[model samples]
Target: MGTADAFHSSRTHHAAQGAAISELVDRKFAGRTFGGSIRRRLQVRSHDGPSTDAGRKARQAILLVPEHEGEASSIMCGWLDASRRVAELRPFSSVRTSHKTRFGSEIDLPEAEYEAATEALRVYLSLQAFEITFEVPVEPSGRLPRPRRLSSAAEVPASAPEARASESWGLIVLAALVGFSVCYLLVLLGVIG
Candidate 1:
């Protein structure tokens, strides 16, 4: 290979231990760089919540890239309805992924969507470049939160259960918003007690 070309080389290394990883990328990529391989995986999923979760017509393809070596990244999907409006995704690091199916507007993965997903993966796998931050505060129950600036995910040392409790604040806030919306609707209809 004199000139640059995609997929310069590929190799898989199996450890002597148990099955920890399925595949590893160790070769010249896009023919532009050599060495410093990034761990990656391609996954297809029907629904995120559970087996009972709907959207049978929906399907998601996730390209998992460890932001940091050996660290797991979150899965995300962008679903487009008949109106061309993409379903809102949260805690989604990349807006490139999506859900597609025959019933929806998109029958299969489109060129642009694939390109976006690859681009996002490229950035995350980049040996160098880019930064993002988001932070939120925790308040005691039955008390209003104080104003504060937020930053991206950070390394917080907490117990296992506490860590989960903290990460779940997003759901708590969402539920509160839903409750307020319902209450407002009831008030507008003069159905409030």
Candidate 2:
């Protein structure tokens, strides 16, 4: 195919994917408020706490958003502690945090909640390329049972140790190839055997 045809095909594929993702997100988060900008995406929820640990204080706000910019694709959902010092995530992504710490503020999620949150994150990440700005009404009452330190379904970051090691190996092979080429050229010119 021609260059123009290939470009047009690629563009069309991306557009179709975007449309499908938007539809899926609309259906998935039918009744949740959508917040965040083009660069970031999040769903904001608020409701009464289920257990005493949550306390019968003011309505607690929960945010389902990406863990961090470095792991933009990795998402977690939870509210903050009373002190607001740490983000208490339930159904937390196992994608190691920026600090490389094994543990942090996380709570275990119930099976039902885990499924719901996992579906939500999947829907969110699907439409990540486009700007999502639709807001669904938050439930006035009833708790959405959810998780804490569960493994994340997000993709591993490119900078993971395994990925870095593979890159290093590639660089070494490339350097050896370049060195062999230089030696071969010198031999051809009778400068070295």
Candidate 1 residues lying further than 4 Å off, grouped into runs, are 1-37, 46-61, 65-69, 72-193
Per-model tally of clashing residue pairs: 5, 10
Which parts of model 2 are misplaced by more than 4 Å? Answer: 1-118, 126-178, 181-193
Q: Each model's TM-score?
A: 0.19, 0.23
lDDT of 1 at 89: 22
Which residue pairs in candidate 1 have backbone atoms (N, alpha carbon, C) closer than 3 angstroms, thus clashing?
133-151, 133-152, 134-151, 134-152, 135-151
Superposed Cα deviation of residue 96, candidate 1 (Å): 9.6
What tens digits encode model 1's per-residue C-alpha lDDT throughout 1-193?
6432222221111111001111111222222221123333332222223221122233233333333555434334322111111122222223222222223333233344444444543443233221222212223242444655422221222244467887799789999999999999999999996
Per residue, candidate 2 scores C-alpha lDDT tens digits across 98-163 of 113434543323334444554565445434532212222122343332423322322223236578
